[model samples]
Target: MDAAPIIVHRPRGTGGRRVTVRGQIIGLAHSDRDLIEFLRQSGLDETTAEEMVGSNSAMIEWRGGRPHDYAAA
Candidate 1:
């Protein structure tokens, strides 16, 4: 069976930044290495980037344009 798509909405006005690969967002994040590199470039330094991206499930929610909640999926 195919998997349902998981929606991770990017809040509006995020400096118009979006992750796209081969002209699409889907399948862009195809591996942990890519995610870690993205997090680092997104400003999370090496340690934090590694930790966050290494996890299986990481959910970050924001309120007032800042990270207000985080939890595992």
Candidate 2:
């Protein structure tokens, strides 16, 4: 089976943030609303967005950092 698309949050320089799905850069998201909008713009439904945001399957990365899997949290 294909792996589920991973939602990633990364810290951008100048204190901004960006979101990506399946390695494709979506858009900047500094808050939940912005993240939702980015996900929607990336063609994800509301349900999928919620799942991705709340799921332990998501990933997060900081500037000059390695990916941190939420599943470990």
- Candidate 1: what lDDT? 0.39
Error of 2 at 33 (Å): 2.3
For candidate 1, write residues 1-73 as lDDT tens digits.
Answer: 4321222223344221233322334322323555556556656698885765455333322223323112221
In candidate 2, which residue ranges exceed 4 Å CA deviation? 1-9, 58-73
Ten consecutive residues with minimal summed lDDT in candidate 1? 61-70
Error of 1 at 73 (Å): 19
lDDT tens string, model 2, 1-73?
6544644545555544656567787776566566666776778797776666655443433333333221211
Task: Give candidate 1 misplaced runs (Cα > 4 Å).
Answer: 1-27, 56-73
Q: How accurate locally, in lDDT, is each candidate?
A: 0.39, 0.55
